[model samples]
Target: MRALIRFLFLLAVVAALVLAGAYYFAGRAAGPQIEIHRPTRLLGRTGTLDVSIQAPGGRFNDVTVALTQQGRTVPILQLLNPDAGGAPPDPRTKLTQETGDRIRVTHPLDRQTLPGLREGAAVITVTAGRPVLFGLRTTASSADRRVEVRLTPPKVSILSTHHYINHGGSEMVVYRVDPPGAESGVRVGQLQYPGYPATGAGVQADPTVKVAFFALLYDQDLNTPIELFARDEAGNQSRASFDYRVFPKAFRKSRIDVDTRFMERVIPEIADHTPELSVSTASADELLKAYLVVNGDLRRKNAAFIREQARTTVPEILWAGAFAQLGNSQVESGFADYRTYYFDGREIDRQVHLGFDLAVTANVPIVAANAGRVVFADYLGIYGNSVIIDHGMGVQSLYGHLSSIGVKPQQNVANGREIGKSGMTGLAGGDHLHFTMLVDGQMVSPVEWWDPHWIEDRVLRKLREARSRPS
Candidate 1:
């Protein structure tokens, strides 16, 4: 009996050692690990889910993703069998993959498809299981996410009238927004021009009312809808159209002849300063091609750079009344002139002259069109020695081809202040000043801003009404 008892004790000790070795190698105590990556808060009606799993020393046997609401289980996806489990229709958005013992899946959620998203509180559960080496399969789950979705859009309305805008001119609109947090703006084409808090200068200072100066680009389609748009954080959008009249004007066209002397002088001057063209050492033919490329390709890049500077502006009104032009200067060219360039009796290129060219001899004083801060004062590609002034609220003026700049960037200059001197620095045939009026960086006819009568009837009259109205 003593020998038998000793033999049983030895057998029990051997069994305990084998079990400990198997568990240590397989990591059965930890079980499968699951990690869920989700946003801390969901302000929008739609969101997404990105899940990652780490199964050590085991292969994933079952994986399920589901949305639970009102005791209803809507299965989002399952990865049971590679052949039996079909993927979402769009693999880029919803996908499941496994590499070794790890698995990952990403899915996008929309309120329209996922009805549970409309519920006030919905739970998203992810459960995963793995098969271990010792038949110690374990399951892990995470149901910690309870989402809140909003779907109501904000309201916007126009308060002021006489919304007449010329084809290549600027106009101001006064509007009101219900929720101050919503982003309200003017939507024209793909671009949205945001509105600002109204000032007591033009429109009465109201917390809800917003003032926005918008432009109708010369090349914009007449049938395009220009409406006030508002959107909330929940992805809800709203639009309201105001009564307005657009007067379309036919722009003047001109043909410019590019001769040997014109090419010889402009090319050498440009090539000497601009090495980006790589045409300083080229022949006459190559120089002409380079000029065409500069006029076409480089022109767009210069305009884009100028437009990007309009993003930051003072909210207050910096200037009032009609803008002042360069005194004793004659208008040499008009705005929006469709020009055709001819070289050696053949048409080489075509471009639109956006601003007016004022001639006042060589190196004449150029004054600030209105009171504003200088945004940019440097050499540009086509408009060399350029200076741009911001007159607040998306209204700005640009002076190009200057002989010398007098003001630095961010310097405040009043109306009629000398900012620079004009010269034939850029792509020009003679000494002239390129003056342009930009509304939100879109080139508009400066003739409107130069006429005092137009300002009183269209712009100042609207301001007078706003001032007289009970605040």
Candidate 2:
């Protein structure tokens, strides 16, 4: 009985030894275990944030990284073929092939990252594992890592001290940027006043980052305040305020007198020819409205004609400033009745001269300031022998009190081309040309358009700069 028991005990000991050896060999073949060297961490916002993972002993097929913000998992990185599963000498779980080794991953936080993800603190978790038993098994979990993201937006500041104010049209507001960066991504908020036109925002390297804003003033009320706002990529914001005070402007009445000889002659001839003579006395305001209506009608009628003719020729009309006549002139009292006529007279009595008198010798050649089509070259109510030209884009020029009309309706004329001769027509006092400019039906100061330098610096320059800016 004792011998038999010893044999059985010896057999049991051999079996135990074999099992222990097998377990040892299996663990060795599996290779060294891999652990996350550093837990995934959050980085501040508004800039690049780099995260890295380290695998010790290189015993992982791949590394899985996840970012969590406010308990929500964020997809930071995705690994392909993360687990290497193969037959095992000592079970698949225990034995890892040479293919399954160290695994490392990296995640970068950029502008494209989730919005709230960059706002506050976030958690990063990294897991290292390999394929075992036809499934992925985590070998080690990284320690919890936390990161803070900050929101930093761009900044905007106006370089000028005071806001620019003008009569009523397009205006540019220039601003300077502190740190030059990506300007295309910036957004500008609307102004307080709704009447202001859309603003043209852009950046420049030479003069400075400029935002050319266009605003309109319908009413002449002063002390109007306008607000502007800007925001950057990181959610940063800036604001500015400007006020415009509409001051009273003085109205200057031209002291020069108009000679009525030309008008006197034309009216009698027109009466003799046409049985019905249309005679109307128009004030400055009424005359402007009439000019617009007539000009528009003429443009519509001669659209094709103007386009075909002016396409090849430059404008011939030239704009001259208000001038006074050196020779003797006579003025009629009023439109009511030809009661009194004054020669070389300066009277603040009977009739008030509303416009500046342009004195030119009779039969002197008159030209256009720009290329355009003649819309009207007939007798106007009180304008007498008049010619109106359409210059496109809601701009029109008028020449009244002409001795003779050279260009007929629908005729194209080039700049500096003779359209008529200076004469005292309509309700004029002398033989001189009357020139006027209208914008969108409203009469603007002709003096401004006459200055080429002003147009280049203010109008053309802004347009060129706006076109060059990136959309």
Query: Could you say which candidate leads in lDDT?
Result: 1
Tens digits of per-residue lDDT for model 2 on 171-284?
Answer: 334455433342421122222211111132223333325443333333333344454454444434455554433333343333433234433444454444333433332444
Off by over 4 Å in 2: 1-248, 254-356
For candidate 1, the TM-score is 0.81
Per-residue lDDT over 14-97 for candidate 1, one digit per residue giving the tens place of the 0 to 100 score: 999997787666554554567667634453556567777666643566667777766777776666622234554445445455
Clashes of 1: 0
Tell me how candidate 2 scores on lDDT. Answer: 0.46
Which parts of model 1 have CA positions greater than 4 angstroms off? Answer: 1-42, 45-110, 116-148, 200-204, 271-277
How close is each model in CA RMSD to the real structure? Answer: 5.1, 22.5
